[model samples]
Target: MAAPGPVHEALAALPLVDHHCHGAVTADLSAAQFASLLTEGAAWPGVSPFDSPAGVAVRRHCAPLLDLPRHAPPADYVARRAELGWQEVNRRFLTASGAGVFCVDTGYAPYPLTSPAELAAAAGATACEVVRLERIAESVAAGGVTAGGYATAFEAAAEAAVRRPGVVAVKSVAAYRTGFALDPERPAAPEVARAAGRWLARGGRLDDPVLLRHVLWTAVGLGLPLQLHTGFGDADLRLDHADPALLTDWLRRTAGTVPVLLLHCWPYHRQAAYLAAVFEQVYLDVGLALHHTGPARCRAVLEEALEITPFRKLLYSSDAYGVAEFHHLGALCFRQGLAGLLQDRVDADELSLGDALRIADWTGRDNARRLYGPPVSEPARDSGGPPTRKV
Candidate 1:
């Protein structure tokens, strides 16, 4: 891909609406804690997390945002970050992300992170929440459910959670739990009750296949977009089973009823692209994987994702959690990767400059706006004033 040119400049200037992401950490982290957040794996004995692609990317892209030079030494970067503190670091990265809106998944938080409201305040943007289905199920189960009332209780919890103010969608980490290999048809009442009985009796995590399926369909019944963790997560996920293609049957059943967003489909991005091509409800984003691949190499992942995926079926997300740097890095890599790919087509005369810029807008901002509804206007780059919320 060519160096920064007109297309890259245009993309950099365009505002974004991050359609799926998580909150940023609120407190300063220790070195180990910070390193732990850099990768999906457990901290090892003597290895530096900075040795990886994601770590290098952080040093390269996020270092300068913190006022450090490019490729800053790991110790220097961490010390500089500590010196600035979380609030300043967060403000620098979140504002620099250029996202006018943040659609945050308010689950999977393991740290003292900012709330969607806090994140909105930090970035000077509007924020909406995406309820996680499993968390709701676990909450309901912990509230003393009986075998007979399990199905109704779960449905009620799911309904109530999604109905809450600011919840624009529902999400599931089923790939981490039962995977997508289960029956697509809604579980029978008796099966769900029995499963719940076993789970509540165990008083442990909710990996029950029946309960997981129930949560999914209940979310669908609520008539909100459903985001599923399809591929590339922490070690807990069975990567082989997390493929989006495994959910084909579920897609067929949920089609036309709800939008199904597949998140972080990395190795199976082509499969996700195919599903997006075939199913109107299916959509995708590579999220953290984009910037994790680093700006220079992320274009291939985007290329694979866009090969057959409809332009509208693609969306933007950072899937950023724990740290605000991801919010910046994800946007940076996405702009670099997408602009590089689109600009190449224009240079090759395969796409008109007008079409390339239009597609860029669609992927970066407009598509997310259409999917999630209008943003509450802020003092955005191109905005006349604070964007008014869609009633």
Candidate 2:
């Protein structure tokens, strides 16, 4: 690789605020378990995830950090990872990620994963929590709240969850639950009661559309930035329904209520960019997609996402769950992809150097700081290694 340009240098030095992500698995993973986590799909017979883009990316980008050669064989990579143990592996990658603040989603832990504080400690960074609204709602139902009392019980529970110290935001997996094609307006009390009754009786994951809308609207009332999963998730999601464009009416109705962060809009990135351009409260990050696209295609994904997005509306996040390699890979892809795009525009005279540099800082760090407030403690500057060159 050639030397990094000025924009690259600036981005390299900046402390990224990973505005949305999940905890890394603290336990050592077997090769098969690691492979399953690489792709959003299941590990089918006669197929290896290592041949896929994300799997190849781990070998190409993350192998060397484990003291193995770049593009190392899958067996070699997995062996080295186990030899180093999960803690040391996590320390190496999380430190290398250059993230100063991690806003961790404390929901959906099928595995025993690091807590926000543990993740921060491993990286020498600060941490904040993003309460998952659906989890809270589920707990309310599990606690045997009546349908008539579900509305008030859920509201109180959500409010209390956000009030916990270090909680900076809240999120909903509505895309996975019911998608975004529902009525835009908040449900009436009786409507919510009926919906809650049906959901409580069924007693499973919260998927009722009326209840989904109710939780979303309740999030609006909470007045914290809300993150929504938009596109390209596991096999459970219907791709067509995960489009951010489907939230048009909801965005319109909830204008100026709370900042709604659209997460991982890959196939619908163009739509997400449009939403960010038109709605003042809408923001986005192509986090989960970054590592999956890998370094080779990351720039193209970012270019499309930034096509019409207001500079302030684009934020950085890893959305990294399970493997620590994603923490490093997400940051690596983001820095390389974004710097390549902005630097080219500068070279083409389409953007001034100062503006490009400022955009890097805003997208990488400041925008998240402004939204989440300052970290619990100041972020460590040394975690990312030395800058490529001083800004």
TM-score of every model?
Answer: 0.94, 0.95
Question: Considering summed lDDT, which 10 consecutive residues are worst modelled in model 1?
Answer: 382-391
Candidate 2: segments with Cα more than 4 A from true spot: 376-391
Which portions of model 1 miss their true places by more than 4 Å?
1-3, 374-391
lDDT string for model 1 (174-263, tens) is 899988899999988888888888888888777988888888888778777789998898899999999999999988988777778899
Query: For all candidates, what are the clash counts?
Result: 4, 0
Highest lDDT against the true fold, candidate: 2
**Model-by-model lDDT, in order?**
0.85, 0.90
Q: How big is the positional error of residue 388 in model 1, measured in Å on the Cα after superposition? A: 19
- The global Cα lDDT (0 to 1) of model 1 is 0.85
Given candidate 1, what's the lDDT at residue 294? 82
